[model samples]
Target chain A: MALSIAGAGRNALTEKAAWFSESLARGLKVARAFDRDQPKMRISEVAAKTGMTRASARRYLLTLKSLGYVGSENEWFYPLPRILELGYAFVSSARLEEFVEPILQRLSEATDAAAHFAVFDNNETLCLGSVFSQKLFGFFISIGARQPAYAGSMGKVLLAGLSDTKLEEYLASVRRVAHTKETVTSAAILRREITEVREQGYALNRGEMTPGIVGVAVPVRNKDGTVASVVNANWISTSSIKAAEIKRCLGPLREAAKQIEMRLASGAVPTGWVSRER
Target chain B: MALSIAGAGRNALTEKAAWFSESLARGLKVARAFDRDQPKMRISEVAAKTGMTRASARRYLLTLKSLGYVGSENEWFYPLPRILELGYAFVSSARLEEFVEPILQRLSEATDAAAHFAVFDNNETLCLGSVFSQKLFGFFISIGARQPAYAGSMGKVLLAGLSDTKLEEYLASVRRVAHTKETVTSAAILRREITEVREQGYALNRGEMTPGIVGVAVPVRNKDGTVASVVNANWISTSSIKAAEIKRCLGPLREAAKQIEMRLASGAVPTGWVSRER
Candidate 1:
């Protein structure tokens, strides 16, 4: 998947301006190179993953260490606490959490499931808010976790609500890697599913992202009817009542979406604050 | 607070390596310049906060905008969704969430109050895990949030666990800004409270961080008897049973800490994994 991910826009960084610093971009990438799968990376691994030479990667990593962004044990590098300031500034700066959180509580309680609110960030789904489920065997994720758009229910819902041009850009940029047996890895199949979501006004996932976990979602529209976010309720499906769960969740899910829209329209959510979900 | 924050190591960046690129560090700083109170910044404000020259700040901010890290409304710069990736990487990479979360849930259930686990992140306390209270008016904070080492209860416990040398470094590095009227701004007073925490084996706060917010925290230790992290239970003290509440929560809180320590000592959490949570 060398060319597969890199060419497919595996996770886009904003296009550099004429004056944009490539070193800065690489530095941020070095910071991000440490995640759930590889919390610590050897300098060579960082060099390979970031596509930087060993010397370049070492310099960046060492600089990050001095800046308190990177911590090391032997040769492996991991992020430190000060790194949280970057993402915290992003979410709280939007102030979307305040209004979206109460709605998340209501939606989660009413449906008795974990709820998530996410917006489109470049080519991936950026989770802005999450309320944990009461179920012992539920899918739990943090607010800042990112997932691909074509595979996850929240991603599909947000993608379905995008404008024609934005949708085309997203489809063109996405990597159709199969995450599970149920994942739609073909761009044509995904496009069809997204179209159906646009028509049906909701999106549903049955083990597409994570096997045995089902998710149902809807788009939250801004006053201008543009998609501000996609909110979802997820559960672990050990039983056979998949249809029943979807049927039960859609009503509250849509209701919560409307409440969010009403609040957004009422000016509690600033107009033009959130860009297009993409 | 122009020179105040910059000189105080406001948002520390690693010092430049002999070959490290300062532009990368400045670029990351440009992304963080946007926050709740100043979500949108004019060009001058960016230069002022980052201490970059006007032309340099504009170039970095423009570069961040092109990269989708920042957004613009006319001339003001705001952070976009991409910034979430930074903090998210830090928390998930540690994987402490899985082990620490259940303890938080159990503790919250036992006390019917908010429960949190934090670790020493340099001079600040980084909240590793949190289970929100069912109370509508409880003190709610997301995981990965940071508080000063001298002010909050969790900060005090973590700081108290440090060695003499490390403690001296922290005391010297910390800026004792008074957030609340009751905040301990004097170095002598803070040192005394931290020493008391070491003696008593826990730390307590009454309207220190926030006027009506009271917090009680204890340190979580590893097998070798070094502190791994600090855990706290907090509530809104609208009622007068502050003394009784602390006493009631202490047993369950300490038990939760032991449970966490046992888990950490049991090899579920990798040794040499959390090197800096001293």
Candidate 2:
């Protein structure tokens, strides 16, 4: 991404954005510094993480602190709830959260399992919305967590939606490593699984990505029948799940996917509709 | 808030933050224009909503489009998922999510009802985390959704946590309109309810905020014996709720609150430990 930005001449997107207020980007970067791994950062630490000098970091931190985005305590600084407005804008604008949220919650409530809606971005499954059941303890999953697309049921359902050539290209380039004893390691076996998933209209995974966790996924399609995302349900236990147990979820999961498809047809998705419709 | 900001002199927090990046704030304002009511907007609409000139709004929109913060479809523009990084920072930074999440899910799983953790912010309750049940169609509520502090069980629990002076002053200024026929409109009645809540250690309400919902909230305290937030469970239906049903939830709700208090004492809350602990 940086290479493309640098290679482009004047009037490039990055150059134009940085033309007026560079501090805007800097302030945003300061806000971006906090994430799951490093939620709290010291003044010196922000400087190191973002490659800004200590003075520059301090000035921006002080600016953000005043702006209500950054909250300071002793030497450590963290973000406050107001920062969520930024994210809320995206969720509201896209209108994805409104439609997917209730469906996922309902599925979780019905099955007593963790339910999720994930989109295939780049090569990973980005969890957009999730409702976890506390049957045991849930895995460390949160909204926006990315999982490998090659080793899970949700990813497989998404992969099955791709055209033949794209699917073949993905299989050729993707790293085929076993995440667990039950993971499919060979390209040939994964290709067969994807084919089966396409025929069955769902994917079932038994301890593939994480040990002791089983998953089932179905594809949510656009009006044109192209896949937009995947709806997944996960059970966190090593006990072998009977086929009937996994089958019991198929009807509700497909119902949700169809409802999402219907909603997407009515201009409820993030990816533009009217333009594509026209 | 605006008066205090204007009264402060040069180098005040707000002033310093605004000095370098006024347009940044304007861009943020434009992004916030998208909400549940209006998820899409045109350039002219954006200008009207944010009071930015068409030319300036165009520039920032173009910059955001290039920066991947905004997506354009037809003539309307909307925010993209990249904005979520801003809010994800706060959720991660506090680290409260790691502990509170499991307990909320457990409560929801057990009760088959919506369970939420809300903190008193301004004159409202800001939902920090929630696990919703699919028992009935839920109202449009999100993680950051705020409810009036005078109208709901969650709000009353937080209000009951305040000191005598603060509570009196809050009651004096707050606009108390009846949200439902059963809402406590009289300040004296509400005060008595809060006092009873303080004595019993929890609050229960039926058809107070929404017409058909029954709610019970318990206060989660810090080690210093101050209330930090409220844990709430809501049952949806117009059916009259008996005192015993509300009573049944208290034991589990209080248990979860105590668990949260224990976790908060072990360095779990967002506020800096040294300052708050002191």
Estimated TM-score per prediction? Answer: 0.87, 0.84
- lDDT (10s digit) by residue, model 1, range A98-133: 767777877887787888888877677778787765
What's the TM for model 2?
A: 0.84
What digit string (tens of lDDT, one per residue) describes model 2 on residues A1-278? 88776778446655665534566667677878987677788989999999998887777787677566677878988877666667777666666556888887677766777888887755667677887665646564566566778888898988888888888888877787889998897888888999999999999878888998988889988777778888888888768667887888887788878877788788766564211201
DockQ, candidate no. 1: 0.56
lDDT tens digits by residue: candidate 1, B1-278: 78876886533534433666889888878888777778788999999999999999988888777667777878777777777887877778766567777788778878877889887776777777877665543466666566777888888888888887888877777778888787888878888988899998988876677777878898898877888788888888754336678788899899999998888788664344354634
Off by over 4 Å in 1: A1-18, A164-173, A186-189, A240-244, A262-278, B1-17, B164-178, B186-189, B240-243, B262-278
Residue-level lDDT of model 2, residues B24-44, one tens digit each, is 666667767777676777899
Among the numbered candidates, top TM-score falls to: 1
lDDT values for all models: 0.78, 0.75
Task: Give the number of the best model, judged by DockQ.
Answer: 1
Q: Identify the candidate with maximal lDDT.
A: 1
